[model samples]
Target: MTAVVSLVEHAPARAFPLPDTVGRALAASKILEEAAPDSYERGMWRLRAGSKVGVVAVAVPGGETVTVRITPKVPVARLFFLLGYSSDPAGWRDGMVDVAEHSELLPALAHAVERQTDRALRRGLLQGYRTVEEASLVVRGRIREAEQIRRRFGMPLPAEVAYDEFTTDIAENRILRAAVDRLLILPGVPQTVRTRLMRQRARLADITPLVRGQVIPAWRPTRLNTRYHQALHLAQVVLDGASAENLPGGLRMDGFLFDMNRVYEDFVCAALREALRPYGGRSALQAKDVHLDECDSVRLRPDFVWYADSGTPRIVADAKYKAGKRRGYPNEDLYQMLAYCTAFGLPEGHLVYAKGSAPHTSHRVRRAGTVLHQHALDLDRQPEALLAEIRELTRRMVAGVKGRI
Candidate 1:
């Protein structure tokens, strides 16, 4: 029999009396390592989930399994909205990929993937031209002269050839196949969902399976691939957010989890960029060339930066998924935004937080002539209201820049 434990995101630590092997498996799993710290304390295992929320299962020795489920602070539907919008801001809409029927994240994701993939492949597998390179017995398309001469000793028999083959074994199908495989291995998938996923897997049986530890093949969105866009995007979300691994001592760990911190940041940046599009300037997420020092020794990457039409930075912003403390949001966020302002040579910088008790506030840095603005976004609001808040925030950002000029 398997033991189950439940925890809430960012809640107080709770102690569970777990078996030694089970505790060790959880500790060794990458999910816990990335989300929590020092899980084992005293006799009972003291576990607390940080920003990550989802379900993970560990198979220990002696046929025992342990599953840990972390519930997010936000509603599952809201969480899906954040994920969908962040994944595809232009194409994603509310109820586009419905998770209303399911309560938990994994089942919702599993069902969504199955439904979307089915719709994508309804007309049959999509075939695209994939470039191939191989040494063939007969020269087919274009022969590699250098390789043919050097490797074959100037022989004409087995030629090194390259050609484009139209096939269903492409990036899109492979990604969908990988997602189905991942869901099949996870423990919590409902039986009906699992059966449908198995059908999806059988449909994609002709597609190539993604190799472990290799970069996922990339696919671009185009008119021909329009039907596959939503399914491929959701497949990538699954591939990026889920993990399965074999642990030491004959244990296996598999999970599907999302870091709420990252989800919040991505949603804010994507929404802001969408909102700022009409302002006639380009917005960048995590621009790498930014630095705080003249000598380029101290590097800084703000979550969002908007450039004016003249190619000068007009606004810089960072996203914080943190709640405000008694005094306020940590002073570190303010200092960080201050640095972003200084580096970007902007009069103001912005920090957007998942709303806490403290309302929107601004502080003028002492002696720096730079202002740090903190905006709180209520994640619980309806999607329209939430995005409306972002548009309002965008207006304020643009207005501030124009006022300074």
Candidate 2:
């Protein structure tokens, strides 16, 4: 059950130096801090540290007096807290090799996706997709498969198989190189990580628990030896269908963003499709790059769009990658979402931001005589918990809009 929050209300309790989750984790981890809390609650939560190096500040009454604040040193558990991975997997970390990975998009493009993927994956498989159009998922699947083999196997084959034998395996598509390359090209797959994962997989697979020199994984039998086992399950499914016939996959996935946008008539709704699922909604990614005057023209791309279960109301939300400062919301963001809500004929809209900042705050704005909300998704939260938060917010927003009308 969720506590209903009114856009009209505000919290006057000042704030704290730490996020509640981080504060709790610190206590649970039970590690003594090297020092005391640099930050205590002042009129504004103050810390004498971050962003730009040199000391800079003076605080007065207005929000105009911005102070340079310090970012606290990240505790060990906090890293896992943000990435949605298991922090204390017990021995799993030892078994789970930290595969050096990278995304293939330019920084701006990739960051745009961070929140999109975060939302969709959290929401559930495809609950966020507007339609089952085509997707380049086949490409992703194919590459993931080859890479898994390499992770399981590895390159520079244990002096057991010579370079010639390895080349033959890769050339014959035993590991499938073309699919690997295509996977790397996915709009969001990181290239550098793909490179390292691929190299490691190829070099390591040839001499594990097999014969006098016949590496057992050569045939890749199922086994349970971290010292010798491989993570090929997902990759294998990918390889199962990698033909011209499968090329239709990317189109469906690619169009998913579009369907979500149309379903609710939201603006350039730029979503990863996965993040919208938990809310029983769909998402899309949009752009105004089509026209040149678009420089001044706002290319407002939203992340998630919702159509009511009874199909009466629709909502649009754009997920922001960064947290906001205490004073107010990012004007550019508010402007963009405003455009989305206006274009979609929606009375309300949302701007959802990642929530790993010192203190997370939700800002509810009144735009065009309707309430527009900015939500903060806690990066430190468990995946299921985050999904629930988004779901409840959607339900409330729809109902709120109806009440306003």
Candidate 3:
């Protein structure tokens, strides 16, 4: 039977095994020395080390392979550059400069900046649809305040102050703006089902609690949900008040900002799958989310399952949010891939982690009379160089599965 080798990059890098990806990245770095003298000039390895990053690159056989280049695939450099933390000058760009001070404000500012500047404009077409109504309420409040209250408070309030007022508006708008343009702001739907606000509103049939009762009570909202909801709500307001073409773009950016985060997993999975495809395999098998059936032993669902021309499980890849291997591969992962490997009784199973600061590759655990190979996959290299290493790793994985290497 032919061999089908596959690599899966860690999408949510932290969820998977970080060390494994780092190991793979480092493993590839070791082979960089062998890259054709000048075939691929620039080669390097950037591993995670706590708060900061550790980047080390080797000059190809020739001089100065690459001065410096920024890549979307490499999250570490982008994160550093976005935060005005790049070690070199060339890595800095207009957007990074444009967002320099503000970049440090957002928690995942680097990823957000990338999405705003580099990612597709329509990348998240349906995201706004998820909270369309809530978005409408939030934005509506802001538009109203910018038109109404901000000026009513004398001068335009500081953006920070406006932000707080906007929160107050969305959470308690139904009560606050009673005579909004003679529209009679009748008490209506609470905008979401999670809230028991409606039950509270049901009791207050008299004057209706706007500023004092509802809005004031919401002052110290507990979880981040209210904030997220307000953000979503504000988004819709902007959508409605804004022009048509930019509406879609704005929605996509907001959604991408909320959902798509650049982590080591995204990097690792990209490399892994890229390696496997050319050799008769599929990299990402968005196979339906596996639901663990705890009937007898354990059954699993794998995000991606690959096979060579010979119909054998070549690689079982999953992305974890945390570093290191957990107790039992999250039960579902174990059983799903076990069924994948055992169904065909393949030789090995591989679990890839998002590369982290730890520094070692992965471990081999023996279970059910089979060898499960867990490894760290890294994501610190030139795009082309990284792809080449993926190809080689694919070859090695396939050969190992076939007992040929």
- The candidate scoring highest on TM-score is 1
- Summed backbone clashes in each candidate are 0, 48, 38
* lDDT per residue (tens digit) for residues 1-405 in model 2: 111111100112223344333233323321211212335442222122111111112222222222221222222132222221221112223213222232211211222223222232232222111112122323221233354345536443222211112122321122223323323333334555455445533533441221222211223322322221122222221232221111121211110010111222221122223334545643334432222233546444455556555554376667665335656557787777766766667777777665533343344455356456766655455444644565565566656656765
Report every candidate's CA lDDT. 0.87, 0.35, 0.34
TM value for model 1: 0.94
Q: What is the C-alpha lDDT profile of model 1 across 225-343, one tens digit per residue?
A: 99999998888888898877887788887788899889999999999999998988899998889889999999998999999899999989999997578667888999898888888
Predicted model with the maximum lDDT: 1
Model 2 residue 101 CA deviation (Å) reads 17
Clashing pairs in 1: none
TM-score of each candidate? 0.94, 0.35, 0.35
Tell me the lDDT of candidate 1: 0.87
Candidates 1 and 3, the one with greater lDDT: 1
Locate the minimum summed-lDDT window of 10 residues in model 2: 252-261
How far out, in Å, is residue 157 in model 2? 39
| Global Cα lDDT for candidate 2 | 0.35
How many backbone overlaps does candidate 2 show? 48
RMSD of each: 2.3, 20.3, 22.3
